[model samples]
Structure formats: structure tokens, C-alpha cells
Target: MDVALVTSLKDGMNLVRYELVACQDSKRGVLILREFAGAAQSLGAGAILVNPWNITEVSNAIGQALDMEPEKREKRHNHNFLHVTTHTAQEWAETFVRYETILSMKLLLLFLGLLSLINQFCGTSLPLLVASSDIILVY
Candidate 1:
């Protein structure tokens, strides 16, 4: 696995970005991620985002990633590394608890309404709902 440059054309919740960030010993690798991927929302600041449908754009990104300076790579890697280290499962659970606790009735109603709409269209069960802070996958 060439962690030096990890590219994903398209993905739902790509864990490869996190894996690369965590495994980079020298923090001198480049991450080329698809803008449409779920991970892009978090890693976009540090990783090079490209459109999978645009070949020219992806090629240009590859060039940029390959030519990126060591200092820039390390800096980008550090940003992602810090996020990966800090945003642990425990932290996420605690944040969710706090968010849910402070959630106003109005907001909860809105969420439930959205969930209801989703369930109606997606044909998912409503008895149990699981969610992450950023995304919700009903299955």
C-alpha cells in the first residue's frame, strides 16, 4: 500500500484516508480524495479534493500531490493526524450525549420529521435509529 499517495475515486465513508493519516510515520504523504466522499467533509481542509468525473482535474491533483513540498505535506498531515487522534469514539459519544441533552424540542421535532420522511421513503424501521454526529445511515 503506497500511503505516499492514496486516491479514492468515490466512496461513501472511506476509512482509507484515516488509515493513511494514522499510518504515516513521517507525516509526509499526500491524500487525494474524491470531493463527493463522506470523508471529504472532514479531510478536505488537509487533503487534496478532486472530482472523480473530471479526468483533467484528477490528473492535475495527482501532479500537485506529487510535487507538494515536504513542509506542506507534513503540515497537512499534522492537521489530519490531530483530528484523528482527538475525535475518538469516546469523544464522539460524549458529544452526542451533550448534543442530544441540549437539543431543543423544536430541533428534535425537525429531526424526527426528517427521520420520518426518510423512513417512509427508504422503508426503514423506526423502532431503533442510530446516528453519528455527521451522518445518519438507516438500515
Candidate 2:
């Protein structure tokens, strides 16, 4: 009976951290929510112990505990500049072709450069090799 325990903590106001502990059985595909409690006793932390069989109830309880009213906190949305926009069929095809061409050219150039370097060094001899060759020829 192999078991794995995973724990994650979220820091909240007043230097208190809330922990969620999950126990999973890899072979049996079972996920058990073992504990969700506060690290410190003095903080206004709560625990919602749940059975593994009642997944929906456990999820709803956790969601209700974590949700906040819109007016209570400032809502912020983060955006990234590199995010791709929706493209038409022709635009998507063009983008894919451009990336494939660039990537293939770069890889080909890299392999060609490596091959040239190997050819240059394959027959070159150092001073130690020349000395050894002279001794062998003399013998």
C-alpha cells in the first residue's frame, strides 16, 4: 500500500499560513483530502476535513471558503505582451510556414558548421604526436 502526501501553503494576512494536505494513492487512482488547517492557533484560520469519496462536496466547501466578495478586494487582471491573438486560416498558415522555414534553416546551418569543424580537426596532429612519430620511425 504505497501512499504519497502533498502539502501546499498559502500565506494570508497577519503572518498566518493556511495549509492544504492531500494524500494520493498512485496505483489505485485515489485522491484523499486529508487536512486543510491553519499553521498557527491564534489566527482566524479554519479547517474543512473531508472524505475522499465526497469529491464534489469537498470541492464546493473549499471554494466557498476561499471565495471573496468583489467589493471587498481590488480586482486585478494580468496581461502578457507575448500572448498570441486569434488568426484567420491564411494568417495561421503563413505563421506556421515562417516558423518552420526559420527553424529548419538554423538547424541546417548548425549541423554544417559542426561538420566543417570536425573535418578540420580530424587529421591535425599536435607536437606530442609528431615527437612520437619521429621516435617510431627511428626505431
Candidate 3:
């Protein structure tokens, strides 16, 4: 909820959805998508959680997000912003990279090992090639 999204809200525009970072991808450590991003639930409870594999569920989540109460929306946004300010995917990556042992050759194998899990997380999407150390791929 930064930059344009928050700016839009500040201008009195209600967010229906985010095209780049969909609400579906808002979750982390959400075991369902963990195989893909290996993240936990960092989003607030206000999110409309759903399985991307289930089209019907996705439709339902969209409806839920669209129909959420204003009070609930406020709570969710607060939670999301607080979480973002403190913890981020970049922080997690930095922590991981800071571990001396993690920078060894084994990390490459670990990345490869996560490929299958990631593949399962990304249904029709192509496998993500994680080659750039400087790149921080967020959901």
C-alpha cells in the first residue's frame, strides 16, 4: 500500500484489484503457494485467500475482495502496511545471503531442488530462472 495504490486511496478511489500484484499473490508462508515463492502469510487477514489452480475459487475471491466492508478494508490495509514497513522479501533475501554457509555451491543445488516445488506453485506459468543475485523477485 505504497506509491500509486495508497495515492489512489488518498484521492478517494477504492481499490478493486491490483493488476501487477493481485490479491491472490498477496499471501506468504501460505503453504499453498510456498512451493512457488517459499513465502509465508505476510499479508493481513483482510485478503481474500484462494487457490489459483481453482478457477471457481479465484472468481469467488475476486467477488469477496470487491465486496469487502470499508471497516475491514481499513484494518487490512493497516496490517499490510505495518508488515511491509518491518519485514520484506528483500530483507529475507538479505538475511539468507548473510548466512555464510548459504552462499556456498550448495545454494545452487538448493535452488534447483526448489524448482519442482516452484513448478507446482506455478501451474501454467513458465519456470522462473533465478540467475541474478541482485534481483529480488517479489509476489
Each candidate: RMSD to true structure? 13.0, 17.1, 18.7
Task: Residues 1-139, candidate 2: write the lDDT tens digits.
Answer: 1211222333234211111111111222111223542322321122333443466776764564345333221111001001112233588899999999999999799669766766666676632221243343211
Report residue 86 deviation for candidate 1 (angstroms). Answer: 1.4
Question: For model 1, which pairs clash?
Answer: none
Worst 10 residues of 2 by lDDT: 75-84
Instruction: Write candidate 3's Cα lDDT for 21-133 as tens digits.
Output: 34333332111111112122444243445545566765655566566665665566555555555665688888887785667767788778767657676875564555456
lDDT of each: 0.77, 0.36, 0.45
User: Runs in model 2 with CA error above 4 Å?
Assistant: 1-86, 125-139
Per-candidate TM equals 0.64, 0.29, 0.38
Give per-residue lDDT, candidate 2, residue 24. 15
* Model 1 poorest 10 in a row by lDDT: 1-10
Candidate 2, residue 87: how far the Cα is off, in Å: 1.3
Collision count for each candidate, in order: 0, 0, 5
What pairs collide in candidate 3?
Answer: 28-39, 28-40, 28-41, 29-39, 29-40
Backbone clashes in model 1: 0
Over 45-125, each residue of candidate 1 has an lDDT whose tens digit, in order, gives 989988877889989988898888888888888988888888878999999988887787668897898778676767644
